[model samples]
Target: MAQQALPVLQPHPSCTACDLATWPGLESPGLPTRVWDGGHTEPQPKKALLLVGSHPGVEENVKGSAFVGVTGQFPNRLYIKGGNLADFADVYLTNAVRCSPRTSELVTPKAVAACREWLDQDVRVLAQCYDEVVILATGENAISSVLQRKESLRTFHQGQVADVGGVECSVFATYLAAILLPSNDPSKILAIREHLLLVWRYLKFGYLPTTVKVPPPSELVGSRVLDPSPTTKLISLDVETYGAFERNHRGRLLPRQTVFHPAKSLHWDGVQRCDLVQTCALSWRSPRGGKLRTKVYRLDRRAECDRLVSVLQRLRQCCVLGQNVPFDVLYLRAFNHRFRRVLARPHCVLYELQVLNFLQNDQRAERSLKNLSLVLGVADYRDEAVDLKKGQRYRDSSDPRAWTYNAKDAQATLLDYEFLVEAISLWYGGDTDKWSSYSRQWYNEVLWLTVQMSENGVHYDVEQLGRVHDRHQVALDWLRDRAKRLWDWPMSGKGSGKARERIIADMIQQYQPEDLGLARQYSRRVKKSRLTGKVSAGKENVWLLMGVVPSRTPDRGKLLAYRRFQRLRKVVESYTGPLLHQVSEEKKTPNQQTALVKGVAHPSWHSVPSYASDEERSFGGTSQCRITPRNPGLQTEPPKIEACRRSRFPSGALVLADESQSEIRVATGLFGDEVFIQRETAVLG
Candidate 1:
């Protein structure tokens, strides 16, 4: 590459124009300081890429060069390893701040503003070399200075192209050098790598993807907009729902007067009916030029709602896509029970982009539609462009705002589906049709079954649970009183670990000196901190103390009572209390053969395949995916002794079974351990 030297662009070695130059560390003896004549090419190279960092680090200050230190070399490795750019060395490097601050804290707004003069000159000169320069701003400070934005960087705007110093350049905002360190979170590392790869793709394409602009959704205006294009094969649908209750700052539900009856008692049945579909938006690729077109309709009237269901029923052959398809389907069903038939059709295809995204990436990545769309280079169409406020519910907003929001969501969903389909197809060896078949199989075999399980939850024997709660409460009270009488411990308050340790220490000190053997045993049971010489009251120490205490003494009796109290307390809190709240608020309706027994808890279940841990997978499900119930988390039931209760079927049938060494057996089968399998087979025979 031919280059030109621009020494006039360099700041004076001893320039003290900014307040950062007066910082104490910069004035330290023997540590040379300079107005960092940043990454100007030896002879300012024409037609070269520019890499901008936040500021000079300690090593950069010592070396008097850009990216010469550990932090500087980080981006070098990242660029090469990511395969985005051939060599970082070929890119001109510079900093937003020419002078190194004592610490990052000193690189405040004022310091950045002071350094902008020299920085602007460098960018303007670089603009002369190329029609439009491409700069990678690698931190918040660099991004802010380059974009002339405020202190913070809008994550979604990272890859946006903007004008800097009257020059149009693609400024790629990404992670700081510090995030590239080994000790940083692995997820952050992975995310930056993905961001760099995206930057490469953007440059290779030679076109900037600006925010998507959609015209105001065409209103129904007393007529129907449910008619789909005859040639349309795929449609993205999204619904905006009006929640009957508004959650306060503390998350306590307060019913809206419009939905709630003042004369009737507040109950679950009423609560369930409060939420209704406000509007529905649908977007499909235009048959003419392949542009996505969206239409929104208000479903406030019964006739309008019926029309939506009718339209959905008519689309049995077309595929429906959404961010969380199940959520939209459930809400639609709640709005109109007739939707059940539409969804029940075996030929009906639904693509849930949320689940698809989860399957493709690590759980650490953001799976929400907004974040995923931005990460995948889809237009934002949210935040500033939408003119929405924080903490404001769109469903409660004006019709125009709500409808616009819904329209954008549907459009984004279709765009995201397009991106993910191609990406997944590439992963499947360029077979898009194969990926489509695989996703459909997963939806039919896994997602739908889990949804049904969530809708029709396990039936609990309320009477049996009530009796257990009562018995445990009585036992807990007795234990609390007995413990208070034996030790000076307060029965009403939750005593701290230190308080327990103090009581244990006092008891050990009062042990009869003549009972030296007993004293020795108790002493060995607890360990004292070397610094404070105070005994620990951790659970392990308590268990050890239980083993040493005499069976007949007050200390042993109190210990047993305390242990029993803890077990009962756990049962009361984790099981009884939460389960009591989880019970259906509606009284039991007449049992029908086809229906799940009503008036029982219906906890939601999730199939988190990527998030399943080894322990979670052990008992989670046969497929090794963690299919767990939420709300009360029934899978996390307490130990038998603590529970001292049995859950029977609603019909009162009880059965018990266990597979011994199930994991070992499963592993043997998986790894083709014929010897172990044959042995087990022989034993069974």
Candidate 2:
């Protein structure tokens, strides 16, 4: 059989400007001429540029083709297996520095810079041929030299998107096969191979299969515009707060040093004062497409809030969207009753995006407006000129950057909403589809339910909480004394008593079974390190002392005492003290003897958990009194800590309902399995 003919190498016409023949160490003795797979020997449309570091090995230089050596074979095989690109003929492969370096010294930065002229010309020519050129910079040096990113390769994530020259591309900053060949670890080889496949996927398609694609740059609108429609409208809202000063867990104003403005004539008579001073809203008529005429409102004055309320009231007839709408609504309600009342039914874009992402099982989706804007192809202006970390207040600062940030936030929110709507529509057919409608309605209902629950907070007895706090304190003292006596870990009475406490803690932390002469019975296990290949402790952790204690061990009593002390300490610090402090003295009404417990407001009662006994839960003492047999434990007890106290329902009625066997029912109904359904029903009955 005749051997296949190899394509002849030729120099690019533009290479003459650099005078490659006269360049030091880059002479054409063993150096291969410019080699590329001229696909079809005809002008077929160019798809992508397969950019790499430098020339092939010695054998490849003789053959005048790239990737003919062992170093290049791994990527060639990966490209074929990935199915995105078939063969070498599919892509135009080139390098940053065209010549292979002599000896072992790789191409210097100076050499790379000198050869950049030829590279840039080649890229420009390729960009003209290809409709969209995707450059795959394979290594750290290639990434820095070609992509011009100043950050180290360690900082770059796999399949990270970056813009090179005029085209958008994905970067894979990993060691090439040449570096991997000498390593004994098979995992490193496999990792680089996988990275190669990812690069192929990115070059063939615009993005990795794992990530959701943003809209093309052409589709994104640079300026804020409102496309007016009769039935529907899109309004983006944002609020800038001085600082969150809500009531603490103890029902007292947090950041106690916060001072309110001396404008007593403002309509804040019966309402709680909040940090909300400025609010921005941008309203656009929708079916968000083409040129849009937008209405922008920036309100800070007390009278301006009334106008903002009127605008929001009008927006209620349309779809009002915002990031974390529940939070904005809470603050707006505090600003004025009318603002809250008007925004009662606004659509929360954050919740909508979350629901969509949940349905698609895309856990990487972020709810922040800034992140969403960047992911959805909108330019973010949050980081320019202003340091948001400094917490500059909009009311106090005269700098235009603050206002610009606020306006951009509102604009980004609107753009993100528009993009999500279109993306979802494409994913699940249309707006009226079952999946699409269900997700939107479910999230809306949840948001409203949360608001209602927060407004009507659960009732708590301050007197009972105080009694519980006192009881826990007494129990903690007893446990501490008992543990100290049992374990011979006495507290210090030295100067600055904290020193003695620290000594006791260190002793407890250093405790082991062997220290108590139980090493023979309770042996420590060993674990091997993945990176350093070192062996260390596997099961001798002091925290896991309870698990290691034998059933008939002599030191069981001492271990149990120490555990009890730890539990008591946690309960006093984490629960009892905080709970006691959070019980607000403000009465709900004159007739009703009810006080509110200030838990986290956003999720309202959703985060609360049911209570359990000491043994069932991790908290120390058993519950002597049972509140209810139906709901045995108090909800929202710190997981494993059983120090949960019973609270009386303000309405004197506690009802709980859940979808009974919903998942099984749905599965049976969908599969039309009558036999399985009958069996489940019989078992349930």
Candidate 3:
């Protein structure tokens, strides 16, 4: 099918300062000639919402309405669904640049400046119609126009409230609808839902209900009861670290090059950051129901931390509890030698709230402390007091906000434990022994092993991995040059995805299987879209081209070379490069320096066992590789790319492996399967 003709707009009589006026196409027949106004149809909207998009699209220009195109309809659908809108008719919609640009890129700063007069007119009309307006700006241009600034989108955060034209509005600025429309990622969808919910919440209430004041850390610690009752069986603890929160998708901290970690420590921003324990909050509460006696320890102050050490020594006698308690334990051990020594003592019982929650609820249920607290009716101040989106952390010892946040976390953990214990007890038919046995054998045991693995992290051969990474880079560069020379197309940049698709389609149309020197059976296997008439460049097609050989036509050569290039790129990007980064560059600890090593990486591991009959136990790598044991994880490294596994374990390390049917044999023997056991023994023999 041929591409549709581009839409064109006639030059406005008022202005002709830019080339957008000269951009050509067919004259729009049914579209509005004049700038469009918002809320023209609605006389009295109960809850007025003014949505501002960057510019009108081809479809919107053709339809004579703002936000009616595919991109616009996506957000409109979300707003109607999530925000409880009666319909699109209930809300006012307009664009910053009223005239549809030939392309979004053509709607320049100068064009936006010229069109600001029209946008201002729309805002004024909408503001007057409603006593209070909720403005949702969906792009940089719209945000800048509404706020009357020349700054970029980074200057604003999502769900921010601002005064527009002397009218207070619960305003929100986010990625354009066009950008978000193509993404099917659940996180992105959830984020938009959260953003819309915040907008509606702020519209109803004057402010977000997150603000809470607490007694200062000094005062809290001063009044802290160090000695708990002899009968106390559980103590819940929580910690606020300096650089553990606010990570991007790749797990890199947002606040890089800060004093939180030494500049030398972040050569590649090690897999696990050198996060410091800012404050440790420990609580001893009545499991029945009452307020918790929580102590917020300022770890930066040596005097205050000593008091915390005394309490930690007593933890062995009582069961220590917290949400993700292993994380707190890891940071605490790193902070003080005495704390580590106290924790190393045998018979230490640790109760992790996350693990317990996982067993009690569905495996997919969110187990964050805030979420758990909210559902348990404990507290909902996760967003209050701190701006996590802005990468807020415990920057200094003097900040009371971090201390209060820490205190709240400890208190909430205690409350969550109380709730979960009862919930689990009731779930187990009030059989305390059954639940206790399960917790002891599964949750606590896994937590102990995970903490131990993290403390003694595996070592890697960085120099060897670096050599492999460099070789992959050289090969990739050669392939890119070859591609550019043959097709005059850049193969490794922003437009590469689209370029790959076009290249694949061309290869399929122009060349036969014999022409590319591939088997005829492999040809015509690529799936083409029925609607778009475009060939898929998905992983399946790429794999089919793996055996392709160089041929006469540049199309075949390009396709074969590109496929090889992608294979090498994946190894470097996913395996070798990240493995090299996983090795820490921080200054070694005293013991590490004595042994002449750089640093250690504490990659995360997770295990969750569902008691249900159908679901199997889930376990393996969580962060560093984020792959599972089934055809994945660090343990399942391919033979060619064995640098990580080969270099990881030290000399004299004892590696364990489970023989096939090990668990099956034990179960069958326990159930008195004498014939099966004899057959198993004969097979093994």
Candidate 4:
């Protein structure tokens, strides 16, 4: 089945700018407006469709009509003045809440009340004239003003029909035109116009129009949500510490006496640039990938971290990811807690940046979490470069270095977190596996907001928390001492590295009651009648545990191996590759759904290990291609198994399959283990 394209909801040209009348900060000759084509407006009956919205521009007040600004004027002249819909049912347009809402424009309670009455008047006027009416709330404000469901954007997008003060109504809510279109997309415009045209027709006839309602902008004033299900978010952060700790001959992170690297004040008269005095950069790339676009934010001010507190508060909505995102997050969290600041936003959804491996044994040495970015592979890391530049600028800028660098690093870290999420979407056909799990990680999205790119936190023991190294160290130390004492007969350096092995051999030879080289009565190799064991001579460099020795004696080969249970130095024999968390879902079976905390899977690592013998043989070795018996684990397949084994032997290896190159190839994900097969394989570690 063909997949449908995702709708790219964007601003319409008629509403490219914010309610222009509201933005006092902008210096505009007139509000941006667009006129619609009257030819496009379809004819209707006596039914009047009242379009309700929030922004009423200054031009609209002057012209006494909706959509009359530079942007609105075009649409008005095209659709209204030219007159097509006006021929049938009169089109009455008005704003639900008057005056423009802007970045700094706070709509007072009294102002809203006044606008409410004015909106009701417009609705009442239409109710008196039409036998049937359809009210369309063009934006969130208009829908919310009537529905009192401001946070209903999700549900409102689905369309709704409800009674508003006994006036039969179907409200269709959409984005404000002035806010949506600048980048032209003809198809989208046509679709929206058609939707409106059909909606008007439905109103004119007796047919009930489909409608949806969304939360109004005012209702969202305090509708922040926490606990993103599926998983929490992670926000990664890093800080660049520069200045020396100030103390009275005592080491302490002092506040008062410590001077920020770059002194405050960054006003360059006309141009806001300043000089730098040694600054550090905190860089990070993300989860599965990183941000390709570098964004440098100069932190020249000493109060940079303080300023960042607000930005981060907003960013904590989604999980943030990064290498050691915790370090920055922890630091930021501490700052907020200490300052008693209500971040307004929740704690950063946190995830440690990592590429986890899911295939093979779980004991392989973990790769260094740091310095493992795609940069080595020539991949661009926008977050790293930009943050580095920003740190330099911040150091160069005349601002408090600590504060600026801390927050700037936080931003960089978060960006990387975000980039990883984006990167996963690109590398894979869709966000699947580890990347998908990331969306569920704690504060991961929140962390994503902080950096350009981010990664998952595959548990790394870099600092070796929880005694993994200590246990191995103790075992190795005992063995080292044992080897030293075993060779006490001679301190010569002949077999320096293998002193213990030489000593053991010499001692066994000298103490032989029966000739040590004599062939045993019933065996060729050393045979142990008492235990199921093999002779050490069978394997090269095999360590033999003789009998128990004194615990204090330097003979760990005897004492540690035979008397005590010791954690070996090589316990971690193998490891899988770094991978992102795919999906944490339960695998379903014919019987029942699997348990939670398990649906995760990792990709297969084609980097397989090869043996020297396999490499030398080159042709048709099992290491390169396997040929299993046609019926595995069965008595009937004995001949097939033997044939398969002999074919892979060094003397019988073949270079080509069949008489010539096989043109038609077929591969099913399923592997019929019972059938003999061969395929090329890569040999790596």
**Clash numbers, per candidate:** 3, 16, 0, 117
Assess every candidate by TM-score: 0.60, 0.50, 0.58, 0.27
What candidate 4 gets wrong by more than 4 Å, as runs, is 1-236, 242-302, 314-318, 333-346, 355-423, 426-428, 431-433, 437-439, 442-498, 504-543, 547-685
Candidate 1 wrongly placed segments (more than 4 Å)? 1-76, 79-189, 195-211, 219-226, 244-275, 381-390, 394-398, 432-436, 482-484, 489-566, 582-598, 610-624, 638-665, 674-685
User: Between the candidate structures 1 and 2, which one is better when assessed by TM-score?
Assistant: 1
Q: How would you encode candidate 3's per-residue C-alpha lDDT over 1-685 as one tens digit per residue?
A: 2222211223233455544555564133222222223323233433456677777778876665666787767665666445654332236666666667765655666666666665545445555545556777776677777776743333344445566655666666544566554442233443345456656655556444432234466656653535455456788788776553444323444443232212122333342333456677777755456445666777767777787777666555687888877777876776666777876636567888866675455322235676546445565653566665456554454566666777788777877777767877876667665357665656677777877765665554566656777888899889888888878767776687678788776666544465454545555576654223356776677665544535575555666677787788777655565555432112122211111125334455455432211011112224221112221134544445553433344555435454446567778879988889888879879
Between prediction 1 and prediction 4, the one with superior lDDT is 1
Most TM-score-accurate candidate: 1
**Candidate 1: RMSD over Cα atoms?**
11.8
- Where is model 2 more than 4 Å wrong at Cα? 1-231, 244-275, 286-290, 293-296, 345-351, 390-399, 428-435, 490-548, 582-635, 638-651, 656-685
CA shift at 482, candidate 4, in angstroms? 12
Error of 1 at 90 (Å): 17
TM-score of 1: 0.60
- Which 10-residue span in candidate 3 carries the lowest summed lDDT? 612-621
User: Which 10 successive residues of model 2 have the least lDDT summed?
Assistant: 608-617
Ranking by lDDT: 1, 3, 2, 4
Candidate 4 per-residue lDDT over residues 103-205, each given as its tens digit: 2123333334445544555455456655554665654556666665552222342124546556756655443444334653222233234335535455445
